[model samples]
Target: MEIQEKKNIYVGVQTTQTRDIRDFFMEIDSYKNILVFAEVGEDKVCDNSLELLGEANRLKNIRNNDSFVIAALVGHNVKKYAPTLFGYGADKVVAFDSPMLEVYRSDLYGEALAGIVRTYHPEIVLVGATALGSELAPTVAAKLRTGLAAHCTALKILDNGQFTQVVPAFGGKVLGDIYIPNHRPQIASIKAGITKKLDYAPKDGVVEDFSCELNGFERMKVTKVEKETETCKSLNEADCIVVGGFGIGSKEEWSKLEELASLLGGANGCTRPVLDAGWVSNEKAMIGTSGVAVRPKAYLGIGVSGAAHHTCGIKDSGLIISINKDENAPIFACSDYKVVADYKKIVPALIEELKARKG
Candidate 1:
């Protein structure tokens, strides 16, 4: 069997006694539901899981009854999280409960997820592009022999049940629209905070048990689990954000941004270069096409060069205020209020003014 790739599209050649692309396309309509991985963290469903659920609900609304939204949850004592999942817009939840499945093991979780996909064929599968999801989504996709659009910034469902995945490429310089027409369960691991969390309204939904057999933790040994000490603020839920870019300069100036964020009672975010420069602790604090997408009430970009990739994340923001040294910076075009000045001088003055006004 030969697979031809032309401009990011994969075309499968016919093989003896194998399903061709046409066969898969013909079978596409039969596949129902937009499935999402309801990943549990510390016995609760994470925000990213809910974000995917909300997005899936939108697509299901567009597709109508032809496609329902379902969540595949795997964990020990995780059935309790199903109500939240349903309230967030899942039609049904498949709970895989077992002691061995408590912690995330790639082999066991992948096998169980693959089994669920085989048993109940869904047209689309969504996972949060978190640490676990990054590891698991690819594994499931490989096991099922399907295409996965990783870290997609946006999604659109066509009339024919096809998905157009939007993501950044070439160091966040360009947006790429990816389509996987000849695949079942169009899998994508969307970055956290790209989609809004669904409004909580409890509804009538079924939680069915999904059983998976697992060996006694023999495949992989977990000697110790060390959680990262630093936790970045959730940009998705922030009403205001203070973002820094490459122009922010030095670690000291980055700390000043943090103080500004604190003064505004919001979070501190950064562009890709800031994150790459180790100015921020985690990728969650980075906002761009390749990073987290935020829709804040007020966004203050300090010393930032507004690249297309960075603007894509904050385009949905309500009021944008940009401070830059260059008057001709592209960021000024998007800013509601633009100040041409050295951010190092202006930021300290602004902080003092804000303090004085509050005092």
Candidate 2:
């Protein structure tokens, strides 16, 4: 591999795959580390991305003992997070630092990630299926011309060293498994809370600074960067979550859900219709494919009709209890405990019991 000096590259970047499918084959020993794309900010790394370091470590323990856990950090002033990446099970951190790469564009980020894979030759790649990741994962996979399993609920390793990516299919009625048999680097974008993150135990890991061509689509440039107030911080880490559905009834009734979450020391979420109905305004509060994916320890679903889109997000909860008026609602199929009752009656009784216990 050759390293280029920092030059102002004006030409558009290009992607080149190493070999054709028929010709692409490597000895098992040749494939090395498990690469994670560590999405970063100026001050902190994305929680979802940091969590993948732990996932990589677990996968390495079970599937490939010889592989190192390598994390690729790309952004301006992001070298500070490399130690945190190391503390969270990363054995190596590849830093692609540059001022021109401050604002994230899908094309440039995609190119840098793809370049890192080519240089390091990692056996597997994992990314957090975030707003940026959802857009970025497919781009990197396209550049490398490999298969990508999107929004995986779970992952398993086969006896023959191949890994399976588990995702929802058939309108959330069945789970589909995906794998890349012919590709050198198998890639999957995992949900935020699917796996646990390691404790912040600082370790002295290897760090390397590298650069990719910072040239692309010249017409586009980020002139302004606005940061929204982080209101949904607990949604990712909250152990208890109370979710409402379209069947949750009138806007006035929705306030009870918030009250329940507050009493339980949890967070509240709603389905997409709740947003469209003007019952809720925050788009980040919606949980599903278009919103946040959470795997809380306990999930309470009231008046949920069990749509495929919404069920996909909560299917992995530690304990799932749902109350719906209809006994045959699709949500019943996914819940561990179900009650065929109305939320109005059940919620108030539960709230009263909790309040009584407090008093």
Candidate 3:
């Protein structure tokens, strides 16, 4: 951390065409700095950016030298977030602020991000695998003629300085580790909430302005954008989660999961199958390798068959209670408390027990 502080002192001295940029590229095949794509929405920085910043901070500490964690922030009025990014361990923030960037247009954001990459030439670039990032990362990568690993579940800087990208393969049956040895800036769009956010620490970091014009990119203009407001508690933040799977016989049974969750002072979650079956009304409720990964204090799996993808999401739960009719359900192998019974019978009993205790 002290090393990064010293490096940030002179970061503002790099002119747009200074020999530093050219010299760094000419002398070193790969720069040591890590870059994170900080996406903004509703004039606020998204949590995914902070997650990546946190991971980048850890990676920087592990590298433990002059390595810096820089953030590429693009949006209107997002310069106010520079201090927050610095608190999250960003050594410097390259902000591209324009009225044209108020809303997310893939082409505009991509072009701006690509320009940053061409100028700074970081060793690794991390982006969130959200809707915007899924589209934005590839576009920037294509423009820069680089490869990107999408939906990465894990990232590690190997002993040989190669960035190892880990993602689910063959429909979550196995995990594949990917590395881009030839690319200058190894890019990866990772899933959100996989890593914990770092504690805030004030730092002396510079927020440099990057200019972009949309004169020729008029075709990529965003006419209108409607934002969705969320009222439900986020599954990732829930301390306790009650999840149902395809074994949840019907929609009515799925509703019982909500009631059970309320009784437990928690929230309801579901596997991908349950979401696909229309049992869960919201996709945010789904927990799997493809969806949100949760590590709650206590997780109750009702009628869950425990697919590999689903179990992988909850593997970090403090206490996993799997209640499935099948005694040999795979979830039982990883569960701390296993009950061999139908959820239809167990759900009511749990609610009643909790009610009696309250009485």
Candidate 4:
């Protein structure tokens, strides 16, 4: 028995160059519309999903002329969030209400999104870089045999009709721009907090209900979903951060740093090396590029070397103060205030001063 080749349809991310190539072969004439997947939670859409909708709305204005933004939302109570999406700029919302989508299962959610893409034939697809989004986007792209760019920090529609996607690379030391040079519906996942969500006046956009019947094979069976305990505090969301580096010496010595953080009503963090040394968990590590990017009211760097990777992460902080023995440390360049002394002596003394003040 021999298999036969089916009709070759480009089922993936589309770019300007790809469009031109497709145009030469008359494939561009079959172009459809853009589609954005809204990651629906139980009661609210994730913030990144709203951000994607805002970006989609912006892209639609540039390309559509008369076309509208199509938002595909999957989950129970998806309809309830359609109005908010409209207020945020979705011209049309395709609600796929289902019990299976209530909790994010990769198999079920991916299949649902893939089915919608096949039905609508969107020219582009955008997703957020959330845990669920990361799982669903790649699967959907693979099922549809399309290209995908992940963790995109920037997105723009070029004049020539191509979507340029930018992401951080080289351990966040540099930025890389990617494009699907030849594909159908261009797919990209944007990282959270990269784009601002817009607040637009509510428009009388249409909301359509979409229903699909899945057979035993087509329907995914989810046996169990285990939730992990969120033990680490998100440094990015913290108001104040106390950072310790090699100068702190040992894990036992970190107590002084913690005392200072407690005095200031802040959380204690460490550099990458300190965390790797079993001094602290990665969650409490506040190293530069590879770790969480923080913008706090006050960031105190204790005995930190201030590598480009670490410095970049805390550059957005409101006030940066560094205490290191090396007067020429790189951290001093970016620190708003610097103390040239041994952090072992300085941190303990500072904690005492804070405690005395409170007394």
Clashing pairs in 1: none
What lDDT does model 2 reach?
0.80
| Candidate 3 Cα RMSD (Å) | 8.4
Model 2 residue pairs with clashes: none
Give TM-scores for every candidate, taking all chains together and pairing residue i with residue i.
Answer: 0.87, 0.82, 0.87, 0.73
Error in Å for residue 305 of model 3: 3.4
Ranking the candidates on lDDT from highest down gives 1, 2, 3, 4
Per-residue CA lDDT of candidate 1, range 119-213, in tens?
Answer: 88998899998889999999998878777888887888777756778766675555666776666767888877678778999998889898755
Which lDDT tens digits does candidate 3 get at residues 1-359?
Answer: 00111110111123446333433444336566899999877667788889899999888877777889989988788899999899887999999989888778887888888888888888889998777898999898777656688877777778886667776666565666776655557788876777668998887788999886655765564668787877678887789999988898889777788888988888889988788888777877888666777889999998888766677678778889889999988788888899998788878998999989978
- Compose the digit string of candidate 2's lDDT tens values, residues 1-359: 01112221111112236455443344435767799999875478988887899999989998756788999998888888888999999999999988867888887888888889888988888999888898888888888767787887667787887677876665555556676666657788876766779988999987899897867633367889898776754676788999999887778988999889988989998888898898977777888755677888999988888776677677678899999999988888889899999788899999999899888
Per-residue lDDT tens digits for candidate 4, residues 1-359, read 01112121223445555443433453543546668898766468777788788788788878865656788988877798888888877878898898766766777777788888877777778898766787888989887666787766567778987777755556444555666655556788865545657976776778888866534423465678775665655565668899999878898998788778878888777888887788886543554544545678999999888765566557668999999999998788888899999887877788888889999
Give the lDDT of residue 145 in candidate 3: 58
lDDT accuracy of residue 242 in candidate 3? 93
Best by lDDT: 1
For residue 349, model 2's alpha carbon misses the true position, in angstroms, by: 4.5
lDDT of 4: 0.73
For residue 157, what is the lDDT in candidate 1? 75
lDDT of every predicted structure (CA atoms) = 0.82, 0.80, 0.79, 0.73
